[model samples]
Target: MAYQTFRQEYLQVPPVTRAYTTACVLTTAAVQLELITPFQLYFNPELIFKHFQIWRLITNYLFFGPVGFNFLFNMIFLYRYCRMLEEGSFRGRTADFVFMFLFGGLLMTLFGLFVNLVFLGQAFTIMLVYVWSRRNPYVRMNFFGLLIFQAPFLPWVLMGFSLLLGNSIIVDLLGIAVGHIYFFLEDVFPNQPGGGRLLRTPSVLKAIFDTPEDDPNYNPLPEERPGGFAWGEGQRLGG
Candidate 1:
C-alpha cells in the first residue's frame, strides 16, 4: 500500500515516518546515479569524519538500496507491521508510532557505527523495528509463496545465516539492542484512549493505554452526522 493510503486510513502519521520514507527514496535515487559517498552516512568513522552529516540520523532509515526483491519484501513486511500497530493505537495518534520507529532506527545506526570503529572496519545495521514490535512471539507472517510461520525465529535464522557467510554480526547485535530499548520505552508511555467502551476491549490498546471504563473509542462511525448540531436551521416548524 502507498504511504498516502496508510495515512488516510490511519488518520495520522508521525513526522519521522515521512522523513524516513523521503530519505529512502532520495538515497535510492542517488545510488542509481552512482553516488556512493553519500551512502557512507550509514557508517561511522574513526575520529571526526568530514562526511559525517547530522542528517544521516534520519536518512539512515531511508537508505535501503534500490528496487529489488529485497526492497519489495522489506516494504511488504513494513506495511503489514506498521499497519497493525497503527490500527491498534488510538485514533489520530500517528506521531507516537513515528517517534518510536525513528528513535529505534537512529540508536541502532549509532550503535552499529561505534561497533564498526571499535572492532570491525565496516558495519551495516539492519532495521529491527518490526522484530521488536512483534512482542508476541506467536505473531506470524507468510514466508515466500509457501511457508507460514512465526517471526521470532526469523531474526535468529537470519543472524545465523549471516554469521555462517561472514556478515557483520556486530551491526545485527546493535540493531537488536536498539529494538529492545524501543520496546521497553513504548511499554512505559502509551497513547490515551480517544473517547469508548472499545478501549476496554482486551487488546494491546487496553494494555498500553490503561484506559478507564468510561473511556470511549470515539472512532468515527458511518451513520454519525457532521457539522452543526441542528440539521435544519431555517426550516419552518409548523407549516
Candidate 2:
C-alpha cells in the first residue's frame, strides 16, 4: 500500500525534476552499496578526453557522497528548487528546461577542467536555487528561522551555510555564475531595448519534448505563482 502511494506521488512531479532527482538518488545509492566508487564518477580531464570516459561528465554531477547530513541537505534544496522551476516558469516547457540542464552541466564541465573540485552535485543544486530565487525575487525566505531575507539573497545564504560547514565556497560561486548567465540570457536580455530572442531551444528539442503552443488542446499547468506565491502577495518560506 505504501509503495503504491509513493508511486502515485512520484508520478505527479513535473517530468524533468522527477527524472533528474531520481538519477541523483539512485547514483548515490549505487555508491552506498559499493557497486561503484566515487573514483569512477569524479570529473577528470584526461579520462574524459584522452581515455574517452564520457560518462564521467554526467556522473560527476550525480553522486553527492555517502548518505548523511550533507547528502540530505543538498538533496532537499535540489529537489525543492528544481521542482519549483519545473512547475513554475518552466511548466509546459520541458524541452527548454532540459536544455537549461544541458547548458548548465556543459558550462560547469568546462569550468571543472581548470578547477580542483571533484563532485559537482552541490554546485548544480546551487545553480537551480540561484535561478529560482531570481525569478521569484519578491519571495521571502527564512533561513533556519534565524535569518529572514527576500528570495534574491537565497544563493548567498546557501553559500554562507557552506562556509559555516567549513566547505569551500568555490562550488557555490560556480553555480551562481552559471545560473546568472542563464537567467540573464533567458529572462533579462530579451526584455531589454533592441534585444531579441537569444537562447532559443532548438527545434529538435522542441519536437521531442514540447507540444506546439498553438495546439488546440494544448494546456499548461494551472494557477502557477512565482515561487509558488501570487506575484503581488509574494511568498514566505522556511525552507
Best by lDDT: 2
Candidate with the greatest TM-score versus the true structure: 2
TM-scores vs. true structure, each candidate = 0.54, 0.89
> Alpha carbon lDDT of residue 88, candidate 1?
50
lDDT of 2 by residue, 62-116 (tens): 9988999899888877877788788778877889999999999988988988888
In model 2, state the lDDT of residue 205: 95
Which sections of candidate 1 miss by over 4 Å? 1-19, 35-40, 45-52, 89-91, 117-133, 145-148, 160-166, 188-239
lDDT of each: 0.44, 0.83
77 Cα displacement, candidate 2 (Å): 0.6
TM-score of 1: 0.54
Error of 2 at 24 (Å): 0.7
Q: What would the per-residue lDDT of candidate 1 be over residues 35-150, giving only the tens digit for each residue?
A: 75444545444322565555555444555546775455445434333443444542345445544554665565556565543321111223443343345354443333244345
